[model samples]
Target: MTRLGYQIPNFTYPGIAADQLFDTVVAQAREADASGFDTVLVMDHFYQLPILGTPDEPMIEAYTLLSALAQHTSKVRLSALVTGNTYRNPTLLAKTVTALDIVSGGRGQLGIGAGWYELEHDSLGYEFGTFTDRFEKLEEALQIILGMLDGKRPSLDGRRYKVSDALNVPAPLSKIPVMIGGGGEKKTLRMVAQYADESNLICAVEDIGRKLDALAAHCEALGRDRSEITVSLQTSACVAPTHDEAVADFEAYLQRNPAAEVRRAGTVVGDPDEVAARFADLLATGVDGVTVNAPANGHVPGRVGLLGQTLAPLIG
Candidate 1:
């Protein structure tokens, strides 16, 4: 079964210098590792996401940072929220993840999805095509990646990608888990049924049960057991000593990212008991794990620990 996870999406924190950016990230990752958070993730993008901060905000390349993080933390699994397939060739991405698994002592995960964030693609020289084109590319990419991870040389002649006896050496130390992040019922969920060890559902609180149902239907139609694919939720959360304090942290977060709008139904902010209550309800929706983002004060010394203390027991 999958376990609790944490995502560090934003690099720009108030009063933190650019040179000190990764130090802050390392702090959060280490804190989570010590606090029983089973996994830690970063976003795979060249630029800071608009939903998080301006493009010019301090953003490090995903795999490089995760590699550096592997040395600093001991137990938590490392990955991107979802690596954008368009950013790197499937073979190279597989090799990179394989190396991560080796260095982290086999605590690496590969979370991927069809690339989005058009602005980054346009500015960074990656091909930004139609939605259908991206999904088709992702499908072919996954085939290559999955095959390579299985220690098999793959030969493919597909529409978006082609390989003639492609090889990945030094395969992962363990069967590195593949997590697909998205909620597209037709394409994404179908891919989850086909290739994913886990699936991340980013939707409103009320919509979780509906998404789980959709995924189950996809699994059933594909002759895949739904239990084989662990379900995870990506939630924005803020936990503090008191309810009002947590809300203030969330509000402060909004001030930092003025363009961001908090999804009241999906966003969680409260004391430990309150946060635990929300986790209980989320668990009842059939989600096996959760990856939380507390962009506001996550870099603080004990904020991530508060989450571990509050909700880790509520999950399996």
Candidate 2:
């Protein structure tokens, strides 16, 4: 059965205060938990994009926010949508997740990805390596994290990282699920097939089939069942009383952020029934989960609730 999840609005709202944004998110998470959403995911970004707002605008650190979230909500699964490999040492990152899992009673998932967004890295004085170099680092970091989580002192000497006798204390109470974010067929998909417990793709109806096909090939190469790896998609969402209202709301949002491209190629933005139907289509593609990115201020809470309350049942 496919599960439906929601991404918390962690970025600063245009006119909202940082503390207010955090409170809004915590309250929304409580509502989402009560509304039956399966997961509450947050993105790991150091700065707000110019299109979204400004770099200097308020942005919260991901793991710190997650620690707060662990205390605020009890039932929902929590995770950073994908933590960048460039941001923290792998051993340290693994230890952080282990602690979070323990504090959250084993409801944490670790989502890791190769770092992108060079502007943030440059502004923060982090190394912005070539694409290949970044991917190598990510792969090495994944190895370190997995090894540490397995309660073994792992040693690695790789092109990008060298680790010897790493220990992560207080192993996760449960086997923490590792989620890899990206659709890079060559390396990312192959790594997901080999290592990740779940994989996330940007939602694009026309391309979803193709992405899954590539993932299937990767699974075949690894001698694993494609079904063993949960499939998830990220989408921008808008829903209203009618299809027309939904489209208008989405267009209004686009108008405000003209430079921001609508990257959710496959999205459901309509009345509850129409949204439910679209989710059903995703399930047909072997998607086991959908993580909807809803707007701030409860603009579409009804729609978000409908997804978990109505759509998930239909798809499941």
The TM-score leader among the candidates is 1
Q: Model 2, residue 158: displacement in angstroms? A: 2.0
List the RMSD of every prediction in angstroms. Answer: 1.4, 2.5
List TM-score per model, in order: 0.96, 0.90
lDDT of 2 by residue, 1-316 (tens): 1156777643545555655777767776777677777777877888875655557756677788888888998888888888988999898899999988898998888988998989999989889899998998998998999999989899999888889999888888888888898878788889999889898886456777888889999999889999888888776566676888777766665665554444334446777778777777767776777777765224334555544565556534
* Candidate 1 lDDT tens digits, 1-316: 2468999988878888888888899999998888889999999988987777789987788999999999999989999998999999999999999999999999889999999999999998999999999999999999999999989999889999889888888889999899999888889989999899999988777888888888899899889988888899888788998999888888887876885664444578899999999888878877898888888779777898888878788876
> Who wins the lDDT comparison?
1
Check candidate 1 and list the clashing pairs. Answer: none
Residue 310, candidate 1: Cα error in Å is: 1.2
